[model samples]
Target: MAVKVAIFDWDGTLVDSVEHIADSLHQAATELGYPALERAAYRNIIGLGIEEALESLYPGITRADMQAMREGYGRYFFTKATTPREVFAGVTEMLADLRGAGLGRAVATGKSRRGLDKALVSSGLGVHFDITRCADETRSKPDPAMLGEILRFYRIEPDEAVMIGDTIYDMEMAQRIGMPAIGVEWGVHDQDTLAAFGPKAIVDSMADLRRALELL
Candidate 1:
């Protein structure tokens, strides 16, 4: 089916912020007098919202501790963020092409509304996406609510939209919602893992992603 709407995941899909995310979490933990999270452990929770990520990482965490982590991590992430973030090569052109081709662009991400909003403005890509759904604004991924909302908002059926993302959460979310999804290898999870969720295709680069979306 041809894609009328293109939904993307922010962190790993459009912007290469894996290191930033991991490092910021580490810094926040240190500042909050908690032990630093292992690199792999931090990497594993990239697609979840801050609260969910904290809960998943620190199983018995109290609400107060979670709030502290959130504030600390957010402070470090925002202050250190160079603004607009570094986008993958060809992303600008890809978004421009998608817009020019008359496709509606949106974001369904694990980032909080504030985080995603700051990124959109900083990265200057806000104009490309007509609508965006964040984890804070809806249920987290693998649940399908975000995609369902996006589909409903645009009056587009699940089959008419293509979810382009980089994680298992993304694939499972779209799959459960009856939407076709394509994975990007350049994100947080490996190709094998993303493929495990049965994406329509998995592309390794932004160029490949653009090509795949074109085919869709």
Candidate 2:
């Protein structure tokens, strides 16, 4: 079936926030008195929930320590939030094309509910999405709950929706639901990493994505 719903990821997919994200993780690690984590350590967990990501990086930390790290990351991020980053080229056009094709637009993100909400308005794409599910509100990526909820909300089956994202977590989550996944190269994970999760296609640019999804 043709894709009637296009579910997107926020951070590295639509917008470019890797620098800020890395800085926040570093600050959080520092605040928690953990030695600064290597870039690769934190970068790989970008698609997970705050608790899950921190736990993955620190593996042996206590609940309180995780909470402290989470809080510190949020604080550090907000403090550095000066100018908002623009979405990838043709992103707005992509959304418009999807809308014009009568395809439903949604977001399944690793960010917290508040973080996703803030990004929606700040990025000026709030009006484009018909639904959004955040990490705090559901099981994080690589789990199918978020995609399942979106499909249920729209009363559509997995095949009718396409997951568009930049990370392996996003691809894995879609695979769990038997939905098609399209990976983007500009995100946290490289093409090979995302490909191992079995995406339908991995596009190098927004233009290529348009062709892959037939958004045009």
Candidate 3:
């Protein structure tokens, strides 16, 4: 089936912000008297929203404290941390190509509205997305509300859309909604795990991604 819309996951898929994310979480954890998370564990839990991620990483932490930590981390990352978020190579070209082909593009992420805005501004790829869905405005990944809403808003059928992500949540969201998915290898999750989701295709590099979408 042809793909008319391309929905992307922001964090691990388009931009490599895992280090910034880990640093922010580590600072938050330290301030909250909790241990820092390992990079791999952090990557695995990132698709969940802040509250869920906190609960998963720091079991027994109070909800209020977790909320406070999230606030503190967001403040630090947005204001203090100017860490350069590295966009995958060829992303700009790929987006341009997709747009030239008349494909729609949007983002569905677990990042809060404020956080998503900050990252997009920092990454300089904000203009590439026609619509951006944040956790604050919609249900988080695995819930499929984010994807469903984007599809509805654009008047695109699920079969006419494809989700491109680096994590399982992206795959699950697409699968649950009956949309095609293309798992990117450079993102957070293991390529093997992404392949297990039976993606219509899995891209090893951004160039490969261009070819995959072209074929679609």
Candidate 2 regions with alpha-carbon error over 4 angstroms: 80-84
Q: For candidate 2, lDDT tens digit of each residue in 1-216?
A: 288899999988988887788889998888768988788777889989888898888889999888888888888877743234467777888898788878899999999998888878877888889999999998988898999999999999999999999899999999989999999999899988989988888999888898898841
For each candidate in turn, the TM-score is 0.96, 0.95, 0.93
Error of 3 at 159 (Å): 0.9
Q: Give the range where candidate 2 is weakest over 10 consecutive residues by summed lDDT.
A: 78-87
RMSD in order of candidates: 1.3, 1.7, 1.8
Tens digit of per-residue lDDT, candidate 1, span 29-81: 78877787779888888988888888888888898988988998898889855
- Model 1, residue pairs in steric clash: 84-122, 84-123
Give the CA lDDT, 0 to 100, for residue 215 in model 1: 83
lDDT at residue 173 of model 1 (Cα atoms): 91
lDDT, candidate 3, 1-216, per-residue tens: 278899999888887776677778888888877876677777787777888788888888897898899988886677643234377777877887778778898999988888888777777787788998987787878778999899988898898999999888889989999999999888788878998778989888888888887777
* CA error at residue 97 for candidate 2, angstroms: 1.9
- Candidate 3 deviant stretches above 4 angstroms: 79-85
Give the whole-model CA lDDT for all candidates, comma-separated: 0.87, 0.87, 0.82
Q: List the candidates ranked by lDDT, beginning with the highest.
A: 1, 2, 3
